[model samples]
Target chain A: MQKIINGKAYVLGDNIDTDQIIPAEHLVYSLSDPQESKKYGQFALSGVPRERAGLPDGGVPFITDGNYESEYSIIIGGSNFGCGSSREHAPFALQKAGVKVVVAESYARIFYRNAVDGGFIVPLETTEILKTALKTGDAIEINLNTLKLTNQSDGQTYTLVHPGDVLPIIEAGGLFQYARKAGMIEG
Target chain B: MPMTITEKILAKASGRDAVKPGENIWLNVDTLMTHDVCGPPTIQIWKDEFGGQAKIWDKQKLVIFPDHYIFTNDPHANRNVSILRQFAQEHQLPNYYDVGGERYKGVCHIALAEEGFNRPGTVLIGTDSHTCTAGAFGLFATGVGNTDAAFILGTGKIWEKVPESMKFIFEGEKPEYLTAKDFILQILGDITTDGATYRAMEFDGRAVYDLNIDERMTLTNMAVEAGGMNGIIAADARTEAYINERSSQPYTVFKSDADAGYHSVYEYKASELEPVVAQPHSPDNRAVVRKVQGRKITKAYIGSCTGGKMADFVAAARILKDREVKVPTFVVPASTAVARQLKEDKVNGKTIHQILSDAGCVIAPSSCAACLGGPADTIGRSVDKDVVISTTNRNFPGRMGSKQAEVYLASPLTVAASAVNGVITDPRDAMG
Candidate 1:
């Protein structure tokens, strides 16, 4: 695991559901076909109401129209983030759009498990709500070793909850890898 | 140690005598269900991980239903179903229900009950979140993503954290106007959407026990809407009758110990409740039907696993029997079986299909039409600024299509009542 990871933050408010992360209309696309899967990135977080698309101010697009990748590298959200469906596409879309980490006050269970088990992105639960504390497009540094998030844009810092039992899974880069290490599956 | 029914089911599935909440353990999955939306991707991952020699852990234990996006022009959507068909054909999996076939069942969740995959004291995991609907059988059930499902596919095992159970009790004779939808909507308003996160929701009391199998399914189906690991009711004679009609397989039943611990308890009297709806944009944003009465709506829909059952249609038919709807109404049964029943079942001496059609409801072919807003051509899908009253789960923004549209989630009776007035209306007034 990297000790320090740096990225730009794209924040959202509470109840940011899986439908908003990747709309159902886009679910028909392939997740394995390299070229076809780019649609997931292009439409990542596309369903969020325009007013709640970004934090602090909102109305910012995560990806430019017709583009398959996003400039944002990290997502900051309030409680109950990813609270709707169990579509793994929500996280797959984010990772495909270049998101490396998600810092939220909390998460819906299936989304949290999918993030860790799929090794698509790092879903970090913060002890406190930082959705209002952080702004979209702010420079940020996350230290996995220290479990702290430092905002280079505003010089603010926040503590994140430990990953607990899921830390090994994330470290091994998903459930399959973790299972291999544990000798639960044929290596 | 005393354990909740969910814990006990998990414990047995894991080969343990007891399990405490929050403990992670490997569970032997009794069944794994997947549908068109998630099945293709899960198969892709399973094959990739298990290599060229990939084989399903137990062919008979896997159930695949190509339900979502079945009646679509989208090539990709059709291709997904094709993938599931080919995979099932290769494996000779008897449980595979294909599209355009006599066995094709609509909406995986409702089909799960009609078919006999759900049994008490077992663990069922599916790729769709609403898979928890099977928990109505007193089983441990929840949803997982493609990777976890892929893991289960290869080994028939997946890891789960035991969840604390929450209790909901409703004590009263079920009112004629009150449906399971109203009770669950009331619970959502009280607990918010994430109130029961990572916990089991166990329903009991006379009113719950009074409900038939289809209505019980309505309660468990939306457990995922509240982030619950599962919503369950201990199996009884009613459950046995329903399961026995479809499946002859032997099964075990489980109930919570009298001394089991609960994370929380919510109690309500059924007689005190009235018609209710989860207002547009969120399931947790709730209001009494009377409170929102006269709120103008452009369309009315009655369908999906949450609604659209035989009982759901009977409720709607009772309200629409001799009246015409003021709005464009849609009635898409959750399964073809329900559709056939509509044609044969009677309401006030007329078939439900005839009554709904006379009432100006467009009876669409079942397969989850417009409930999740499929391809652009889907029937009943919401459009820009359209206000809809629907009998479906989850009113999240854009859940039924167009983000600009609004959806009010209500019971079939309430939806039918509202359909008659072209606005949100209480079922109580119409019942008279």
Candidate 2:
């Protein structure tokens, strides 16, 4: 696992639910297919503006239609990120779309587990002050070894908590790999 | 150290005498459930990662339900079932309830309990967030994602953290008009949606014990809405009897220590509570039913794991027995067993099913119909600009069918009463 990551951040608001991350309508594609990654990546945030059930009509999209992966690799979000639904596809889609780390004030339990168990993305916890300090398109650098995040754009530094017990899974590239190494399953 | 019920269950699953909050351990799952929406992908990932020759850790423990998106005729929806059917056959899975068969169950959460997988002192994981419903039986249960479920499919084990426990003591007797839905909505309203995130919600007190198993399940079912890792109630005589009727498996009954540590404790007087509804967009955006009265609606839906139990239907039937529904009302049984119970249950002289049918309610098949906003052909789906009062969890934007359609979540009684009046009517008003 990368101990340090430097990337641009995409900011999202509170309660970024599983439907908003990846709607049920776009989940028709089979995960068994070889092109599953590309299919999921393309539809990663398609529901951002139009699919949320009861919210307002429009907001700033975190991942636009264009090639966003090239410009951003981190997602900065408010409280209760991934609050609804136990769909792993939320994190899977973000990982497939090239999101590496998700920094949130807090996360829904299942999403935090999925991010760690699937090793699809790293979920880091920070204070509300850090959430307010960061902005979309800001150049951020995170050092897991040091438990700190640096905003290169503004020369600000913030403390972050590395999700414990998740480091081993990330180092092994996912739960299955970690399980194999731990001898819980046949290698 | 003294342990909460959640900690105790996790400790047993992880082969420990005791465990603490935030301690991660490998859990030997007693059961893992996957539905049609996530089942195919889970199977796919299992095959991809574990190889074609890998065998399931335990066929008896792996339950598959093709509940969501099953009634639709769309090819994509049909394909999901076919995949599950093929996988079940390939694995010779004993628990796969294929669609169009006598064994087909309805919602996975309800069927899990009905089929006896929700034994006390067991660790249950499902692909749906509502999997927490099983915790009502005095167990530790929570939802996982496709990848984690796939891992369980191959290993029969999951890595989990012991969540902190929050104790909710509901004092006093619940009013007749207030159902578990209203109680949970009141808690959600007070705590907001994320109040209990990453914690175990341990519900107890005289009020919770007074509730039947179905109503207890409702409390646990919506715990996820509060971002709770799981919701649990201790197994008493009622829970034991309920499990004994459905299952023969030997199980332990675990309870929290008298001095067990809790992250927080919330005490409520059940008698003081009123019928409440979660307003548009969020389950935590709640208001008293009296405040939202006369809000016109185009549709009324009464089904889903949260509201499709036999007791829920009986409550709705009590209100709609003699009245004709004013709007397009739909009643979907959560499972075939519930539907059968409805057919067999008599109110006065007519079966519950007959009363509902007589009242112009569309009695659909037992499935998660229109809950996840199924294909275009899904029955009871909300259309453009439709204001629907549903009993399903989650009214997020585009939740039912159309982004433009608005959804208000309420109790089955409230939904039935609202259906009769073509508006959001409080159950108390209609009961009179």
Worst 10 residues of 2 chain A by lDDT: A49-58
Residue range B1-432, candidate 1, lDDT tens digits: 999899889999999999999999999999999999999999999989889767789988899988879888989889998999899988899899988868988888889888888988889999988998998998888999999999999999999999999999999898999899999999999999999999999999999999999999999999988889999999999999888888888789988999999999999999999889999789989999889999999999999989999999999988998899999999999998899889998766799999999999999888877888777878999999999999999878888999999999999999999999888889988986
Give candidate 2 misplaced runs (Cα > 4 Å): A50-71, A129-132
A14-85 per-residue lDDT for model 2 (tens digits):
788887787776666675565644667776766554423112223545555654343578888888989888
TM-score of chain A of each: 0.98, 0.87
Candidate 2: pairs in clash:
A52-B397, A53-B396, A53-B397, A53-B398, A54-B396, A54-B397
**How far out, in Å, is residue A124 in model 2?**
1.8
Q: Candidate 1 lDDT, tens digit per residue, A1-187?
A: 6668899999999999998999898899999999999999999999999998887787999999889998899999999989888899999999999999999988999999999999999999997878888889999999999999999997988998999988999999999999989998885
Give the alpha carbon lDDT tens digit for every residue of B1-432 in model 2.
Answer: 999999999999999999999887889999999998899988887887888667799998999999988777788779989999999998789999989989998999999989988999999999999999999999999999988999888888888778999999999999999899998998899888899988999999999999999999999999999999999999999999989999999899999999999999999999999999999988999999999999999999999999989989999998999899999999999999999999998989899999999999999999988887877888988889999999889987767877778899999999999999999999998895
Candidate No. with top DockQ: 1
CAPRI-style class, candidate 1: high
| Ten residues in sequence with the least summed lDDT for candidate 1 chain A | A1-10
lDDT of each: 0.92, 0.87
Residue A142 error, candidate 1, Å? 0.5
Task: Summing lDDT over every window of 10 consecutive residues in candidate 2 chain B, give the lowest-scoring window.
Answer: B396-405
